[model samples]
Target: MNETTLTAGKPGQSEAKNNKMGRLAAASSIGTTLEWYDFTVYNLMAALVFNHIFFPSFSPLVGTILAFSTYAVGYISRPFGGVIFGHLGDKLGRRWVLIATLMLMGVVTAAMGLLPTYFQWGILSPVALVTLRFLQGAAIGGEWAGSVLLTMEHGRQDQRGRNASFTQIGPSFGTLLGAGFIALITYVLTAEQFMDWGWRIPFFSSVLLVVLGLWLRKGVDETPVFKALETSENKADLPLKEVMVAHWPRLLISGSVRIGSDIMYAILMVFTLTYVTTILGLPRSEALTATMLGAAVHVFAVPFFGSLSDKIGRRVVYAMGALGSIIWVFVFFFLLHTLNPIYICFAVVVGMVFQAMMYGPQASFITEQFPTRVRYAGSSLAYTLGGIIGGGFSPLIMTFLLKEYNQSLPISIFASIGLTVTLLALFSAKETANKPLAE
Candidate 1:
């Protein structure tokens, strides 16, 4: 396709074609949203319920640490997932990889709900949980890049940021769904009941979501970019090798640019969720509710920032978000320190806004850096590697910082440092908003 033809709608194209594109975007978005819902449910459970259920033998602090460590296991496994699935996605196709990932994540997540507890299974309980969590990590590692490519490559070039932003909104909706479900159960159940079975419901419910996601994804066509690559002599025999040899600098920059948003998400959505109720003595329901509200706002914020990137530039919008993280790192903790539910909600919502700003433009920004033949491997590796460094250990690191220093100041500084790396990345990256996919 020529530049003008690919970037803009062809003259006399039917309205049905436009509608199909919209549906494709919706399918990609919804599938990713469900995937994230499964992941977030696990994260929230790890923070609140997993320690008690899976590591009952350990003391409270030890059990919590172990649970978060298990959570980190997912991140550690993501790079392996990225490489394995990324290689296949670039070689085989984006559709089949996504379908396989969805099935794997759904089955593993539901199995988590049915697994025997530490009391019933002895040492085997935590081991099973960790095994499932690792699989979950791997599935997600591949899921994200494929899902973004599905929409972006099919979308008009000028609207790639907006199309990719649809996938970014998934996390917000997923977090909202996961947190809202857990919050509802917590509100309705007694503390004993919640610990007993309330947590399992969310995990068990993932099967229905998986069926829906699969159905939606099955109807969508393969991305035009991947299809084009398949017919071209330019296709690499080893996409990963090509990525490393030809695109290492772009890969490193893509990963570095992700540091700010990933760390911010880990700190705000994961660590802070644990911090408020555990350290600050806030009610569990209150914390989840505040997070749910923030997630609702995030749904809107992602698309807004994404469309803004199409106008100004990806780097500018991303830099704004990184800067927001630096400024809000302290303010977020201060609001939580106030001990008021309203202030707590403000803190979480503001933090999500910053996160959305970076995440919104991120899919197109990173994908645009690489060509279609190696796009899957390149983007997935950069994103999941960033997940490992920036988000994977964030909760564990935050817990350690709080335990050692007994202050949020140290944690804020840690977050600021990650954002600084992102700022440097933005400065280094070429503006990709106007670039064609065939470049």
Candidate 2:
């Protein structure tokens, strides 16, 4: 097929095509939501519960470090997942690879609920947990790229930013679900009961979400861009190799742009839970409730910013977000220090909104950098690498900074440095909101 034919459908599509795109976006969103729900739950558990359950022998500080280390292990595996799955999604198709990722994530996450604690199995428990976490990381490594591509490739060109935003909202919705569920569990169970078994329920319940994701995803068609690539016999056989050779700079740009937003998210949603309960002497329920509320705001914030990107441009909105992070990091910690639940909620919610401005337009921005033939591999590699730099070790770094300096200033400076990198990257990137998909 020619580029003309590939782009021809847009000018004359009826309401039927529009309806199909809507359904496809919904399915993609639901699948991504489940994927992030499993991920967010794991991060929350790593922060609040895993140290006690899996690394019981260590001192509190050491245990928290070790727990976050295991959390980092998952992130370490993500790039590998991206390379592997990105190649397949580029060479094969988006649909089956996404289904495979969903199943892999669900099974491993549920298995986490059944694992023996350190007391029951000694060194083996943490080892097993880390192994499962790695696999979970790998699964999500490919999930985000595929989810975004599915929606964007199927969506109207003028609305790609808004459509891609649907996928972006997954993390926020997942955060909401994960935090809300944990809050509910904590509220209902005494601390003793919670430590004993409450955490497992969320992990185990992932099976239900997996089934729903599978059902929803299975009903959708492969994206039009991928379909066009197949018809043109232009699919990349070694997508990663191609991406490395021809698009490395764009990959670096994509990853850099994500640093500020990703780090902000990791700190707000995961590390803050630990910071509040441990340092601020707040109740666990209070922290979780604040996070849940923040995530709820993020669900709306992401799409709003995403749609706004459609009008203004991805880079402008994204740079604003990166700049916001550079300015807001100090305020975020200050609000947390106030020990007022209201201030705490404001901190988390407002911080996430700033991050959302970046994340909302991020999907289409990165995907547009590569041609259809290698978009999956290129975008996934950039995203997962960004996760490694920006998110994987953020909590550990924050913990170390706080422990060594005994103040939030060091962490705020660390965040500022990352956002500065993102701002530089935004300045270097082309405005891609109105670009047609490369053939």
Candidate 3:
């Protein structure tokens, strides 16, 4: 089936295709949105709430280290999520796997809201928090590749970049919602009330979003590409095994490609929240507002770059973003260092735009690298593993660096090093646009 994102034609055919693709895109987006929202929300809570609530016995610095350490543990579990859900995705279907992940995240995130603090549950509290984060990470592990493929496979070959990018909107939306929701909660409540109950509101609200996601996904058919793969009876019973054994090189490239974007996102979106508040002595609202504004532009930037990739090729756009960010990281810090809100917002928005360039095309880029038989497993593993390498521990690393060196330059330099690796991977990756979707 040939489908266009924009089509004005016979109501019965062209319009139907467009509607179908639109619905699929909408449904796919919720998973990614939830994934990133959860990731972002947890980052905020770790920096602001968990370090104090869950690890009250430790020094503030050590407590934050512990909070973020739990955050990193969540990333460590993504591969398990990838392996489990990816096997089911490749063997069973994308639609159900997505629904399953949504269900899992909704439950876990809400559970996080109900968790007892250290003052209440002692060691059991943090233990439970870690367990929930682990489970939450696992749910997100399957979301990225599955969501990207959800729309990409249903659209026209030539427009795969734009189609895949439709789902990429999740991260920015997630960041926006997470930051916006937390910002609102913080604004309304006194700091004491916020620490006690306000943070739980956002986590509880995730239940509603998950319900909406499930409703949107209901009755949605599996992607035509996956359906065809199923009919061919070419399914890999253990898709993760096949991917690891047969496509490790592609896996390396795909995973490395994610490192820069993941790290950049963690920096621009997540770490800055910590930096601005703890280091600069700004109000939490200031940092939240900066990150939120940056994510707002990122929402538009993603599709723009995704479409650009179709014209200029993925490598050019992806590498451009990677290279641009390497240089921009320093400028980003300089702007932040000035202690000007206007400068801070400007730095974050530009930094996010550069990240968007790579992220916009990433879904199509990585998914196109592997055959449909193991596409879910291959793409999920790459994404989750890269998050582990870059996004997972970055906040912890940046926090540690600041404590050790009392400077932001090392943080910028460290971020640049990861983007440099991303550029290398972008060069090594085959240009996948205007090519057949691997079967």
Candidate 4:
């Protein structure tokens, strides 16, 4: 791996490297596909259905908030999974831990689909939902790091950004698959039918995805980097302990780097569904269609941006994304306010495009902040910490603000704070796009 090989992000890679990466990418994609599928569906259910099924006794607005609180619980639980599984990933290897995380998410998500509503279960219904959501969050927390590392570590040094993009596609494909499935169900089922049993079908379908993921990942091996670490006497040296004691400040900065993107995603993908329906009095299907199309375009855009990061720089692409979002969010709301379907679609598509710029290079950028020894723990901890403040609670906070003020201004203000934090992180952080990973 000399300069030429490292810089040959083009088609000059050996046949062996390409074939190996293709297999790893395929395996990693399926598992992460399941992760985001659950993510999109669960959040949609929390916003649209859970309020009705699990908290029918409360006011509609109050129930939405409570349902979102349950959604928040998952985020709150992510750090635990990050710490527990991150340590395991570094201690053991990235491959098996991912399998475990995949299975955990599958079982827990299916359980949510099987759960009875409040009328049938009394106080147990909502409680059970929260618990399941927590486990789902934990699974995702661990899955992200392993997937990113598996691809990044296995691929050529120059191609890390593109390789990591495969992992990033999880959300794109998962959101598409999940949203498409939900949309089909909603289109065919009557409100009564959807409320009764249709919602459960998606949850139960997780088993099939988990099975597929297991088969694909079964043949995948541990990353060469981790295998090398295993041969070393230190073997990363208590990854979690090393990360926290020596790299606490990095955690804060890396975590805050996510504040903007998370806030943007929460608004465009999550909160917009609620906002369009409840605030603007738009049809539920309209909002869904907008986001579905937005996510669809992202499938291509994400990879392109990832490749672009290799050419220009990771920090440049990353900061540009945050800046674009800060400017575009206001436009997103304005378009939605028009109540024109075409503009609505445009707004959301552009919104997702901004996300593509950020998310495309995200895995490599963040993971590069840590050395090989502490990467799993440091990266995972930073990721979950960002989740807690950014994606985890942004929707809930925005919803409360909307209810309190009857305006979108507060929402924009809050999102700006998240993006601002990201810019600050980029300013303080070193550019790692052209650099080799620290040993």
Candidate 5:
């Protein structure tokens, strides 16, 4: 074909390409959403019901801490999950591990939704719930890293940031979906009824979503990158060991980049829920509504900034996000302390937007940092370690901080951590813009 004909065909071809990307993005987004739906429901339940339902024997304050501890169980299990599934994903292919993890998460979450409360079964009920939460955590450990690799591997090298952002969008979308579902259930039923039977709707609803996500996933072609590794016979013999031996520095750098992101996530997702209801004395519904709205904004902001990273280099965009997070850290708490619900919502939305900058391009940057032989292991290991160090203790630490000093102390701590990590990640990491995949 002539150059003119080939150039003209690019538009039509581009549409086809985007359609494929959209499908891949949907599969990744929906699977991650359902996985998160299962995981985050624990947080929502922790905030609303777990204290009474699971840990009713403890003092109210003790119950809250205990409930949050169960939430942390999931994050704690993440590294093990990453190691296990990271090895599997690298060896068995991303598609199978992805599907398997989703199934495992769905089963555990549904069971949690149906399990009797501590009021009925006593301590066993809470123990059961904690066990299920751990399973959900491990499954999700595999889910996020695998989903990011799936989309990043399928997309063009130039658009990896945007594509990777789709995976990160899962949390915001899942949070909104879970929150919205709970809101609807509450609206349809009385407060007493919601606490009695209505709270289970969000968890029970996940089955249908999982099936739909699986259906979408079945149609996707395997990632070209994975296939290339398989064909080139360049796959790692011991993926986890290879990842550690060959890519330890990249893994550490990537994990550092995640400290701010994970802390911000906890600050926004878990701690803020407590801050509003306990300290600020806002109604739980108002707090949830504000959080739901902030998450709604993030669903768009993440992808927009992800796409923006396609034009600008990854480092610049990520550094901006980190800096924005540092600024927002103090402001987020200050606004919440002010106790104006509208201001609470505004501060949260802005904070999440800043969060999107780091989150949007992170999966691609992490994945791109390593070669395909150990890509899955490297990505999952780095990402999970970040979650463990950055997020695992965030709720606990924030609680301790608030109890130890004042609210401002937590904000100061958050800003310092965010700024320190942002600067470190900004200066140390290589820019991945226009870099070839599998390089």
Candidate 6:
């Protein structure tokens, strides 16, 4: 079979017959939203219920710390998930991997909602929770790369950034949804009611959204580029190995490119919630509200920046965003510490918007670094490595840093990391704005 034989381009159709940015964006957004919903809900739970429900035997602070450690467990599992699914996706097809990842995320999350609490089942409860979280981590590890690749490969080459941004909006959308649900539950019920049963609502509700996403994704066509490779029998024999040898430098650079975005995300989305509600004497609803609003702004900023990348180039857009992060980390933290809800909202929303400049173009930018044959493995490996280094330990580190060096130190450290990675990414990669899809 050849590309010509496998494709049904019809008489006048070229890439346009296969590329449909609108359809791809819809599919990608739904898939991304579902996966992120599963991934971030654990963080929400950690912020609130996990300490009491999963680690009840420990001191409140100790239990909270232990529960948050479980959240980090998910990130640790992501790379192996990437390796396994990346191999399968590179070998089988992007569509298969997408379905598998989504199902895994949905089932694990729903089961988590139903798990016995520590009071009911002893330590096995936390053990069960951590194991389920690992599965969600692994599922998301694979889900993100596949979702981004599907959109990018199926979209018009010229608009890859915008299309990919739509995919990345999954996190922003998922974060907002997760926070909103928790907020609503918190608002309607007392803290005792929320811990007793309300937390389960968000987790269990994942089933419906997952089903819808799977259905939408099923209707989407396989990426033309992957189809072309499969038809030509040109799939890489060992995608990970090949990528390691041939594009090793790029894999490193791409991994670093994501650090800035992920660290900012952890700080803005996860840690800040803890900071405001716990440290500043703000209500849980108020902190979640600010985070939710920031996420809403992030949704818009993601696509806007992604579309901007389509015109200006990935590097220029990303560098500007990274520079903003390096500059804003201090100011953002300062405002949050002020304990004024209005200023806190402004600070977080601004941080999220600046973060979006890098995130919006991220999916397409990373995927474009490799050819179709190894795109799945390469992008997944690089992207997950970034997540682990940048996001996985960030919250924990911030918690530790705050304990030792006061509030300002954590932001300073994170900012330094963002600036370092930004420089490395800018210096290492060529601008990929209008580059033709890899052959």
lDDT of 6 by residue, 179-201 (tens): 88778788899888988988888
**Top candidate when judged by lDDT against the true structure:** 3
**How many residue-pair clashes does candidate 1 contain?**
0
- Model 1 off-target regions past 4 Å? 2-4, 7-14
Candidate 4 lDDT score relative to the true structure: 0.87
RMSD of 4: 2.1
Model 6 stretches astray by more than 4 angstroms: 1-20
Writing each residue's lDDT as its tens digit, candidate 3 over 116-146 gives 8999999999999999999998998877778
Per-model TM values vs. the true structure: 0.97, 0.97, 0.97, 0.96, 0.94, 0.94
Question: Backbone clashes in each candidate structure, one number apiece?
Answer: 0, 0, 0, 1, 0, 0
Please provide, for model 5 over 325-372, each residue's C-alpha lDDT reduced to its tens digit, 9 standing for 90 to 100: 777787777788778889988888888888888888877777777778
TM-score of 5: 0.94
lDDT, candidate 6, equals 0.83
Off by over 4 Å in 5: 1-12
Q: What lDDT does the true structure give each of the candidates?
A: 0.87, 0.87, 0.88, 0.87, 0.81, 0.83
Give per-residue lDDT, candidate 1, residue 180. Answer: 88
Which has the higher lDDT value, candidate number 1 or candidate number 3? 3
Q: Which ten residues in a row have the lowest lDDT in candidate 3?
A: 1-10
Candidate 2 at residue 219, lDDT? 87
